[model samples]
Target: MEEMKRVLKETVDRLFQEMNGRFVRLNEIDEKFGFLLDLKGLIYDEKDYDLKKKCNELGQFYVSDIDGNELDE
Candidate 1:
């Protein structure tokens, strides 16, 4: 169980980093923030995995092109 958790955590961490990088690159394009990358609120369920159990949230990523002050048009 411990080993599974550790591996899961590592996988989640790597996924978050990759997602963040992709979001950043997309944001760099001057094409008016077409879509928002909001993976920070992702919910993971262990039941969905091979192990029919429950695990806590492993990681999160939140990278966006638009700012809070920006208006949606």
Candidate 2:
């Protein structure tokens, strides 16, 4: 009976260790994915700002052209 108890305890301990390792791995994956998402967001924001600036410049050029101002100089 004592030997059976020892074997059961060892099995439980091994299972717990495996589960803990898996949990740690999953947490690491989550952290990495979060970082990637933040980077993607930042890139998109920069692109949006660049597009907005271009649009504004184009609008100014159109207005200046209508006023007979030289745009190429």
Candidate 3:
């Protein structure tokens, strides 16, 4: 488990470093982190997660889109 966490961290860090040279938007980063956080919560059993409950909390500052691009404002 520790090794998996280490590898995941390293992979994410490497991706971030690689993307540092590109033109990335701030909200795009936020959306990506939000997706990651949601997965992390599920993995760590932060609570009894469900689709309906999560959907209700969506955009209320909890989970965001899982695999969608951020819309233009």
Which predicted model would earn the best lDDT? 2
Candidate 1 weakest lDDT stretch, 10 residues: 51-60
| Model 3 ranges off by over 4 Å | 24-73
RMSD of each: 18.1, 17.1, 14.4
- Write candidate 2's Cα lDDT for 1-73 as tens digits: 9999999999999999999999999997664334334555445665444434433454465665432223212
Native-to-model Cα distance after best TM-score fit, residue 1 in candidate 2, in Å: 0.7
**lDDT tens digits, residues 4-69, model 1?**
999999999999999999988877642232222222322242343421111111111122432233
Candidate 2 yields a Cα-based lDDT of 0.58
lDDT of 3 at 25: 67
Instruction: Name the candidate, 1 or 3, with the larger lDDT value.
Output: 3
Clashes of each: 0, 0, 0
What is the per-residue lDDT of model 3 for residues 1-73, given as tens digits with 9 covering 90 to 100?
9999999999999999878745356666655345446766656655564534443444344435431223211
RMSD of 2: 17.1
Task: Evaluate model 3: give its TM-score.
Answer: 0.30
